[model samples]
Every structure is written in C-alpha cells, then in structure tokens.
Target: MPDAQTPQLAFHNVSFAFDETPVLRNVSFELSSGETLIVLGAAGSGKTVLLKTALGLLRPTQGRVVLFGADVTAGSEREWFDIRSRIGVLFQEGGLFDSLDVADNVAYPLRNQPLRQCPEEQVLPKVEESLKFVDLGHTLDKYPSELSGGMRRRVGIARAIVTQPELMLYDSPTAGLDPITANIIVALITKGRDVRNATTVMVTHRFQDGEILAGFRYDTAAGGLGLTPDHRGDTQTRFLVLREGEMVFLGTQAELEASQDSYVSKFVPHT
Candidate 1:
C-alpha cells in the first residue's frame, strides 16, 4: 500500500495522441486526498481526454501516470481493474443504463468485477444509502428515461459515489442543464465531497463551477452549501485551465481571476 503522503493521482509530463494527431501535450498535475481540481477549457481543449487518461482509459504516448503512488502508465487493462474499482466516475450526461432501474444501476459496482465478492445482502442497502446520499432515495425504481435530466444526473452521481471511492472524476456534470439545475448538481457534488472527504477532479467549461468548488462547502447542519471563505485553506480547491490540449494555467481561484493572459482570462467570469 502507498503511504498516506502519496498523491491520490498524478500525471507526470504526460502526453497522448491518436493516429499521429496530438490531443494532450506534456500535461502534468497532482491531486492529493481531499483536494478538488476543477479543469476548465473550451470545447475540444483535451479536457475529456485528460480525464480519461487519468482514469487509465487512454494510455499516454509519453510520460507517466501515478495512481496511489504507483506508476500505471503502461498498466494492463486487467491490472487496472482493481485500481479502477477504487475510483468513481460520473461520465457526461449521467451515463446510466437506460435498460436498468436506478437501484440496479447503483448496485452495479458491488456486483461486478473487483467488487463482485460483495455479499448479495449488502447490495440493496448500499444502493439505497448511495441514492439517499444524492437526495434520490425515492428513485430506486425509476428508469433513466423516467427521470428528469437533473434527476438522472443525480442518479449518475449516486452511482459514481456508491462505491465510496477514494477518488471521484466528474466529466462536465452540469453540461446541458438550466442554470438552476446546474447549481443544484454542483451543490450535491459539494455535499458529497464534504460528507465523504473524497478527493475530486471535475472537468467543466463553466467558470461558475470552479468558483463554487473553490468558495463553498457543504454545511451539514443546514443540509446545503455555505460560504466558507474563512476556511479557504481547508477547502483545497484549485483550478487548471487547458487550451488546445495544453495546460495553460494551474492555480487557486484567486490566481486564476487575477490572470492577465488573454486565454486564461476568458475563463474567468467578469463581475
């Protein structure tokens, strides 16, 4: 087992390409346990590729990916099974099974590879608890098609978190939703982070998403997000901006806001 000091995820001078076309170039970053990284970029900025590479879905053409303190850039698919089981991912658009009900979807990890040994008796309760965690406890029987877009996204979140993963990767969780719904999704994400103390990496194009992750925390007593500017150090949120497959900036929200670079400043919302 890796020592506690190891970064939960690290990409060292990583680059990825497809058929001679480069998508990411010499990208690198580290996310410690309980810290949150918000990746911002315009469409096709390699944000999704970066997230997938971190998850070992795509091998790097050059460089290394360290997970839990072990190098896994060349790790085989079978070898990645255990590593992946320890992480949770919420893909774009709530990637739920249209054929399955919410309960079945959330219970999938427990009954599948790497976690397949989980007792049958524990599956339902685990599913229920995960759903409740996302405020979707009553949607167990609902299909993805039956739920609203926002609710489906909640189910996606519940599924991502059902494993109580040590790492959570969210790919554009708020993409395609109304502003109100988007905020709600982000609040749930905040609640999950504060409640589980899970390390998180979220990829989004919206600057507000990064702002919320940096400036707010889940208030357990109030059951919602609360301003925690005084606890900024404790929050540990950072922003990473990507442009055309390259990392253009990596810093705190304040630093991001203060950036003078034209490209980086474009992602910073103007008051």
Candidate 2:
C-alpha cells in the first residue's frame, strides 16, 4: 500500500463556500503519485469542488491545495497553467466541444500552446493517436452531436489524456450508462491510470470503483454509511461521507461496514 505521507496531491484544512454559504468544511486528504483515490459522498457533497480545486481552476477559501510540490493556491497564472497542463481531467459530461470534430476536440488543449513544442503536421497524428487510445479511432471526423453518450464521454477522456497529464480527475465517470457500458468506462478509467501511473481522483458514488482507496467511512444507525473490510483481499479503499457542509467520516471501506452511526446507517441499500 502507498504511504499516507507520499502525497502527489494534498489538501490541508481546505474549506470552500459560495456567497458565504459553506459547501465544504475543513476537508483534507492526500494521494500519492500513481495512486487512484476515489472520492465518494451523497449528492451535493462538494466532490466537484474538491476536484476543481485540485485542477487549480478554483481557489479554496481556507487552507492549502498543494500540487507537484507547489502550493497551487499561491501560483501565478502562467505557473498555474503549467501545473494544469501536467494533469488530465475527465468531466462527468465529457466536456467535448460541440463545434469541433472529434479529432479537433482532442487537439484543442495543444492548439497554439507554447508547451506542446510540436510542429503543425504532428498535431493531427497526435490527435489520431489519442482517439485510438480511447478506442474511437474510426470516429475522428465525427461531431459530438453525431456520437452516443458513451462515445462522447470517451472523446472527452481522449482529450483529457491527450496532453499526457500526470494526474487525472474524473467526475461520476459511469453515470447514465448501462451495466456493461459502466464496466467498460471503469475499465478504461483504471487502465489509463495504471498505464500512466497517474495520481487519480474519481468523484463517484458507486462502490465498485471506491474499493481502490485504502480506508473506510463511519456508519450511522440510519444506515446511510458503512465500512469496508481491510482484509477483503481486494485493493483497500477509503470512504468519506459529507453532509450539510460538514465532513462526518473518513475511514477505510472496512471500517465503514462496521459502524452503526445513525447518519451512516441510512445509506446502506436495502434489498
């Protein structure tokens, strides 16, 4: 298991709010390089906010967000852009531009950028290669309106990783899909992380992907929360539960399974 202190991404006492209405309350966590940590919580749990902060797109109202050994909360615009270039983010909706073709969408991040350092002829090939990586090679010329939801999501993923980002942030990657499609998306997400050895953070509600983190969450008698076993023999995963702008629990999946706290108990699905 990765050590807790080996943080590629760290949030220390981070807090955020909109118009003085707090959304996240002193939340903190760390993920080592090449580790995939899935963030879980009920609706409106600030998962997206956390993801954005890590991406350097949003500033935390309190504390620090450290990336690549630099406090992103302190970087200038150019420095921030440079740090952002090293990471890929696959949004829940896939975030592909409707006006551009699939290949162009993949190339969007590289366009006119001083960082790419590649000539014009090379860009199309790189775009083609990214599409191939996402298994959408044949759809390079297609438009977003012409693709299925799954296909569009794949394209968005292609664009995210096209820059070869060192970290990846995915929001609800498997939402709005069938069982088989969801599994495929999960496989793609995991495969990219493993291949790149990138620090991965997934904002998802599903327990299937949550099994990868190395901890648990607190349970309440209401059964909304529970623990996952430490010795389940699968990868260890941590679970964090947030409610009403407060962090209620942060533990391994094993620990969450054993808790009986009312707030956590209500979430255990009833058969």
Candidate 3:
C-alpha cells in the first residue's frame, strides 16, 4: 500500500533515448493525489513521451519511475497490468473500437480483467453509469462512426473514467475541436478532478486550455463550473513546460505567466 504522504506518481531523473536521439533528459516531477499536472511543450519536446513513460509503455533509458510509491521502471508486464488498472489514459484521437458501440467501448476494460472475472450484469450498470457521468447515456447504443468528434471524445472520457481510476492521463483531450466543444471537454476533465477526485496529468499544446483548467472550479452548489477571477494561483493545478527534451518551467499558472525565461516568455505570450 502507498504511504499517506507518497506521491501518486513520481519521475526521478528520468531520461529516454531513441537510439542516439535523446527524447527526455533528466525529467523529474511528482504528482500528488487530487492534484492536476499540465505538461506543455512544442512538438518533439517530449510531452507525449512523458505520458508513455508514466504508463510504462516506454522505459526510461536512465532513472526511475515510481507509481503509488512503488518502483515501476523495470516492472514486468504482469506487474504492469496491476498498476495500469488503477490508471486511466485518454488518447488524443478517442481510441474507441470502431465496431463497438459506446456502451461496449466503455465496458471493454471491465470485461477484459485478467485477474477477476466480471459478469455482464455487473458490467452493464458500470457502463451506464460511466456514460451518464459524461452526459452520454443516450449514446450507449450508438457506434463510434455515428458519433461526432466531440461526442466521440466524450465517450472516450466515459470509457476512461468507467473504472474510477485513481490516476487519469489525458493527451490533448481538447485538440482539434471548436472552442465550445473544447470547453465541454475541459468541463468533463474538471468534473473528473472535482467530482471523482482523480489525480490527473494532461498534455496539451494549447495554453488557453491549460489556463482554463487551472483557473476553473466545479461549483456544485451553483450547478456549473466557474473560473477563479484573474486566473490567480491555484495550488491544485501546476504547470510543467518542456523545451527540446528538457524541463524549462514548472510552477503555478501565475508563476508560469511571471516567468522571464526567453522560451517560456515567448511561448506564454503567444499562447
């Protein structure tokens, strides 16, 4: 079991290389439970690589990755299966099975459990509950082809949260969508963080998305999400900016904006 003060996820001097080309160099960070970490970077700056490393899909060439206080850097696939169950990943393209309907897509993880068998009767309710959480209960019977890009992303969110994962990883959940749809996706992410209280690490190229997520809070009493005026300091949400395989900035939104680094300052103002 993880200690009370153990970070949900931690990277210790992690580095990776594709042959001679280094992808991540000396990356280090810790994500505590109930906190959201937003990673921002330009293309090829190792944003997605960070998520893959956390998921154990790509091993670090150097250093270690700790999840729930347990070293997972060299863990076997069998070990990884247990670790992965407690984490959820939402890919950029909403990687739902084209043949499966919304419900089935959401139910895939539960039904495929290797350690414990889950009956359809038990799984069906979870599917419904997950879809409902994303406001997609009515899309249960609809196939992926029948859903719009935004709807597909919503279903992806439903699928990701169905297991009520302790940690959620999002890779550009709002990419390639209109402002309205992107805001909707952002709201769902907020709901996951606020309502479900899941730890999150999200990668995005858009600074506005990061700003909004860090600035907003789900107001249960008000029945809507509201922004923290002036996007003031939010300790719950932190930013990590990478530039060419190195961490350039790591701080709260206010600190990020206050950064004087040439790369960070240039990137923040335009984004």
Candidate 4:
C-alpha cells in the first residue's frame, strides 16, 4: 500500500449525474507515484467521466477529487490551468489538429507558455526529443491527414509527453486499432511507466491490454522492448474493475484471476 503521505490522485466517494441520469456512483480510488491503474469496463461505464473529474474538467456532484493531495473539485478554470500543466491526457481519438504538422502539434503545449519562459530554441529541441522518444521523429513534417490511425495515435502520445507530466490519463487508447498496432501503443504506454515513471490511469475494455501491462516488464538487456516471463511481485500495476458506475473489484493481477465473481471471471481473457 502507498504510505499515508500524499497520493498522486484520489477520488473519495465521488458521484456524478447528468440531470436525472447518474454516471459515477460512489467511486473511490487512489493512484500513487510511479503506479499504473488500469480501469476495465464496458461502454457507457463512466470511465471517461472519472478521467474528466481527475483533470478537474468536470466536478462531481457528491464527492471531491483530490489531485496531488489538493482538492481541486471546486477550483475555477483559471486555477485549473496551472494544475493541468502537471498532467497529460490522451483522448479516445488522436485529437490532433488537421492543419498542424506532427512537430507543431507536439510543441503546442510548450508554445502556450510564455515566450520568455520557453524560447524558440528550447521548444524545437523538446519537440524533437518527445517525437524521438515515441519513434515518431521521422514524422515530424507529416500532417495528421497524411498519417495512418496508428501513426496518428503515436503522434498524440508524443504530444502528451512533450511536457513530461507527472500524471497521465489515457481514455481507450487501444480502441479501434488492429491487434499489432494496439500492441505498439501498449508498448509506448509501458515505456512511459517504465522509463519516465509517470503515474498512469488508463481506461480500456481489452482484457489482453490490461494483462500485458500488468504482467510485462521492460527488458533493457535486449536493447529492445519485450515481455518478461516471470511475473515480478514488485510490479506497481493494478486493476480496477468498474461495473455500472461502481467499483466491483480492485486488486493485483493474481487476485483478479483468483476471483470467483462471475462478472470478473467473464471479463478475464482466456490464455
């Protein structure tokens, strides 16, 4: 368990509704530094609303969202601007601008800062570094329209990590992609956790993705990324199962597999 100090993200008895429609009901969880929390649920399961609440984009009707130990549920938009800088979000879609090239899109966040704070020279190098990290360095000049869906998603990831945020939120990153391409995106996300040590909360219905992320470790010895056979007990990855706007199960991969809950068993993929 994480110490009693400060959690990177927390939701306490959070509930949200749209008019008479309840979306999230009494959802609560905490993400510590360098941990990855995989949220598994079907469509319309309130996953995206949870992400929005974490980012302070949406306020909960019942409970508050605490970010880095600070309750930002009641914060104004102006106050959220600074808080947002410390977090990164990858939308379900690529969310790239059609008019901008890859490099510019990656640099968009940095450019929003004061010119005196981020000079032109500093901006380009950072953009180049971020793109290189995602293996998209060669696509710097390519427009979103000119790239494939997988490539566009990679570009979106490059843009998200450009500022080196301490927290990352991904909404169905692997949805609607071929298995091979989805694996590539999963690899990139793992890199963020293993290399950058960024705390992450990902929403996905793919059981394979959750398993790969929780079971695999980056093998630096191969000079490339690959899965490790032995499951390290020290893994920081965890699974959170959401059903009907409520948490049904939260545990390690082994615990999840051992669970007798029919709903959880049905969702667990067969090896």
TM-score of each: 0.97, 0.84, 0.94, 0.93
Candidates ranked, most accurate by lDDT first: 1, 3, 4, 2
Poorly placed runs, candidate 2 (over 4 Å): 1-6, 112-114, 212-237, 262-271
Count backbone clashes in candidate 1: 0
Q: How high a TM-score does candidate 2 get?
A: 0.84
Between candidates 2 and 3, which one is better according to lDDT?
Answer: 3
Per-residue lDDT of candidate 4, residues 1-271 (tens digit): 3354579999999999989899899999888888889998888888888888888878899997888778888999877888888888888888899999998999988887432257778989999999988888898888999998888888889888888888999988999999999999988887877777789888998978877778776665664566555663554888888888888889888888888998877778767
Q: 175 in model 1: Cα distance from truth in Å?
A: 0.3
Instruction: Please give, for residues 150-241, the per-residue lDDT of candidate 3 as tens digits.
Output: 99999999888888889999988888999999989988888888777789998998887777778887777886788766654552899999
At residue 161, what lDDT does model 3 achieve?
Answer: 89
- Residue-level lDDT of model 1, residues 148-241, one tens digit each, is 9999889999999888899999999999999999999999888889998999999999999878888899988887888896745568999999
Per-residue alpha-carbon lDDT of candidate 2 for residues 1-271, written as tens digits (9 for 90 to 100): 3354557788899888898888878988777676666676777878888888788777889989988766778777788777777788888888888999998899988884456766778888888888887789999888999998888888888898888887888988878877777766766676666556667788877766565333322233432223336433233335666666566777666566666877654444534
* Candidate with the larger lDDT of 1 and 4: 1
Cα deviation at 166, candidate 1, in Å, is 0.4
In candidate 4, the residue pairs with backbone N, CA or C atoms under 3 Å apart (3 or more residues apart, or in different chains) clash, namely none
Q: Say which candidate scores most in TM-score.
A: 1
Each prediction's Cα lDDT score?
0.91, 0.74, 0.88, 0.84
Better of 2 and 4 by TM-score: 4
Which of 1 and 4 is the better model by TM-score? 1
